[model samples]
Target: MLTNNIIFYSDESSIKISVNKDLFNKMYQYCDKSYPNETGGILIGTYLDKQTAEIVAVIGPSEDSKTWKTRFNRGAKGINKLLKEYWEQGIYYLGEWHFHPNGSPYPSNIDTDTLTSISNNSKYSCPEPILIIISGSHNCYNQKSYLYSSTGQKFEMNC
Candidate 1:
């Protein structure tokens, strides 16, 4: 049921990221299902080169995830297993995606901090990670994509 793909790139034109339309729709569904509460999950995909990457899958929030009207705390339950399975198939963690529930499609301070931590965390093994934030109601949504460097610098990508 997925069709088309959304692509984004950094202003310096050094990074290109793509996501399947279906996966976006799926994210919207998760947001809608969560209603006034916030929700999010991890992005799974592969990098084509040093500057281009494609997101192939989206994992919904785990059962242990906590949501609030203005904040979300993604849980880690079962994520390691999922990532391992995808790794065996040549895919891996690309980044994170979250819903803002009628808020702006921008990274909040906490969001930025989280991405910084992920980028610096030796466990994730990703020096640069992407963060996608979707904002709005059920069918009417807006999104912003950012790539975070290990130093915590955020680069907003144009869609």
Candidate 2:
């Protein structure tokens, strides 16, 4: 069940965001190679069956800014484009994703702030957007994925 603007799906929960394996790899590379410090992107998807949110795509910034670590957000202009696309179809911003160098994939204080800002900034916000953290770049397939709640209040899954 969803409460306080947070939802999850497991082939059982109401909201389910379908993840694309190919796109997941891209996000991983963004952090593991191009930007070892931090990598971020947007989650694109359609609202499903009036219950779950299924992630359909990913969009990363061609530009970025360093914030103690690197940060990526869709530019305002790009977001406008995305909004128009969403309206045309019926989908909207699903959530946000990023990388964690060595932290436990847990929500750091800063992470909580970011999530809060996202939730409060828009009328189209989900109870919580899917927050993904890729960790354990210690080697290769050993990478772990952590899913944080929309509010960055807790881990929805292990990463």
Candidate 3:
């Protein structure tokens, strides 16, 4: 079979997420404490994989929101500013991270639909589109990180 050579960028698969540990800790903590209500944000960085948005850092919503939808919309707005920063630094917004309170850290119905919309909205959205879900099991730290494509297909990061 003659197939085009598939060369995924290396040297980054082993790179531990450079996102501020404190930030991840906070997200993880929030999810753990807010079981059932999902908490989520975006990860920005210069990563090789499209879906696995290397997690250069984690951003959360201000502590006043009383609804998931509110926080989610706030996060979307906040990410626009962050995206500008990433562009200036030649970095990219890889993927999103959210918590699945008391549930598996995988894309739920809303998540799949949301990411599907993201895919349609941008050209940068491509292969390995990552959507990380930190379950109530132990926040984002202990919770598993699942990767999903723009088409709502799930996969695993090289890590």
Give the count of colliding residue pairs in each prediction.
Answer: 0, 6, 4
Query: Model 2, stretches more than 4 Å misplaced?
Result: 1-14, 62-64, 67-77, 138-155
What's the lDDT for candidate 1? 0.92
Q: Give one digit per residue, the lDDT tens place, for model 3 in 1-159.
A: 112211222243332333445555767776766555667766566654432234555566535334452234324455566678777887776667777565665566776777766656665454444565666455234444444545666444333
What ranking emerges by TM-score with the best candidate at the front?
1, 2, 3
Task: TM-score each candidate.
Answer: 0.96, 0.69, 0.64
Residues 5-98, model 2: lDDT tens digits: 2234443233455555666677767766634466667777886677556666666653543422444343444666776777688767876777
Q: Quote model 2's TM-score.
A: 0.69
Model 2 has an lDDT value of 0.57
> Candidate 1 vs candidate 3: which has greater lDDT?
1
Judging by TM-score, tell me the better candidate of 1 and 2. 1
In model 3, where do residues sit more than 4 Å from their true spots? 1-23, 32-36, 48-53, 62-75, 123-127, 137-141, 157-159
Better of 1 and 2 by lDDT: 1
RMSD of each: 1.7, 6.2, 8.2
